[model samples]
Target: MGEIKNRLRKDLTAAMKQRDDFAKSTIRMALAAIQYAEVAGDQARNLSEAEEIAIITKEQRSRTESAQTYADAGRPELAEKEAAEADFLTRYLPQPLSQDELVAIVDAQMAATEAELGAKPTMRQMGAVVKAVNEKVAGRADGKTVAGLVKARINS
Candidate 1:
């Protein structure tokens, strides 16, 4: 049902009715981003749930970065606005995996790979291992963080 996308649409309607300018604008931007991704390349197809989440996550990151830039440039007001938008996007994302949870996942994947290969997997196999771990992670953790953990687990 593309729950996130649908929810955003419904929320947009509610925001408009309530005259909530901030929410209305933010949700509109999010839905536009999602719609843009849906038609990004050849065919203009629908985005899966994961792809939709990824798109929104990327938007949230941009907002967060913009907030930092504004703060660094001595613009607290703009920074706060961007930060608020980023925080709003968080409502649609999966609850982030804690460090302990992520570490456990990395450890489990490495152990399973070792058992399958009849020896410990090396840094060379990190790609496959990371891919597997990312599938398990869904959209809960950042990819770079997952890769770093997998790298450390495989190395030591």
Candidate 2:
């Protein structure tokens, strides 16, 4: 938004004036990503709130992955830096879905499928069950985790 961008610009300037390198760099990175989206034409027009949220989500995910890799390489200082940036980015993202919500979605999908199947179905049912639950919980949970949970639910 024009207002948010203006505020970010002011904050970035203040951070630079204060020699707050981390804050300045993180805000610059986020701004660059927003500009890149515009350049790529995906956001040719003014960005919607949802589009901004998606961009922030992407930045947060990248920061999280980078932090994990840094930690795994025994660079705790760098990892902590990445994590702090992630925390900043997270402020712009939607609240993450909880495990309970995810599980309930998965269960609902299974119940609906079982009702259709009338009883026990073949192993092939796994794919359909997973597909259905995944649609219901799309973008909220990790795909691999959902698949594993669906498999375990199907087996039990």
Candidate 3:
């Protein structure tokens, strides 16, 4: 098993022993997602740390979206639960980039992209710019935020 999967299993056991319902359930759900990802292709295989992080990130995004939908439907209690689940899942993720850090990354990527393309990138090159920035950030920053920054920078 991967380091992350092992750590998650350990944490799940600890949570169960400590009678921490939220932690136990959240970890269980995450493990289930990981397991599903493991067998998701033509053949079963172990997941690398990056793949594990991607699964966890997808899970977090789903919880966040669920929370928003609940809130929009006038269900604050359900929304809070979903939001809390998202927060719990975030513990397994890398520390998120601050706005300043993200902007710095975007700036660096924009420079690289400009150099590669032999000019400042216009909106036409938004895809290339966003792809480069996303690779540099390596999941530390949110996609939408990165895309927004790329769009704004390209436009300016």
Candidate 4:
């Protein structure tokens, strides 16, 4: 019942009314995934906004990976379908950080870590830097990308 969840429901209804089969199906799948996440564990609970965003992010990632697998298997049609679904779900997530923004964040975190250590942070401290960067990035950038940047910055 969060904003994005409500938006997805409204969009699903709109898609159905417009006779847009693919959008309707994709949105339905997203909703089903969110609902499943809600009931996934010991007790039923409403998802906080962050939790809802995480579920949507997970669903989007699943579709993107599925699309890649289908493409690798040479199924262009199926790949396109999954890719479209992933793109649609992106609306519910925050915009990804641009590369320059990402670099600035990593650099800032590296500096902070360096200050804390009273010396330039070495690769050994990459984990701390990455953790700090991730906290600032707040899911906007992929973890691997952040780690790679942090490693490169440490090396340089």
> Which has the greatest TM-score?
1
Give the higher-TM-score candidate: 2 or 4. Answer: 4
Q: How accurate is candidate 3 locally (lDDT)?
A: 0.92
TM-score of each: 0.94, 0.66, 0.93, 0.89
- Cα RMSD, each candidate: 1.2, 4.1, 1.3, 1.7
Clashing pairs in 3: none
Prediction 4 global C-alpha lDDT:
0.88
Q: So what's the TM-score on candidate 4?
A: 0.89
Which runs in model 4 stand beyond 4 Å of their true positions? Answer: none
Error of 2 at 22 (Å): 2.8
Superposed by TM-score, candidate 3 places the C-alpha of residue 83 at a distance from the truth, in angstroms, of 1.4
Query: lDDT by residue for model 2 over 1-156, one digit each (tens)?
Result: 644455568889999999999889999998888777766854466666556656767788899999999999999999999999999876555566788888888888888888898976446898888777766654456667788878888788
lDDT of 1 by residue, 1-156 (tens): 477999999999999999999999999999999998888888788789999889889999999999999999999999999999999999999999999999999999999999999999998899999999999999899999999998888878
lDDT of 1 at 112: 95
lDDT of 3 by residue, 1-156 (tens): 888799899999999999999999999999999999999989999999878988999999999999999999999999999999999999899898999999998999889888898999998889988988887777788899999999999888
Off by over 4 Å in 3: none
Per-model C-alpha lDDT, please?
A: 0.94, 0.78, 0.92, 0.88
Q: Write the per-residue lDDT of candidate 4 for residues 1-156, one digit (tens) a residue.
A: 678789989999899999999888988888898899889999988887777877888899999999999999999999999999899889889899999999998888887888899999997898888888887877688889999998888788
Better of 1 and 2 by lDDT: 1
Which candidate's lDDT is highest?
A: 1
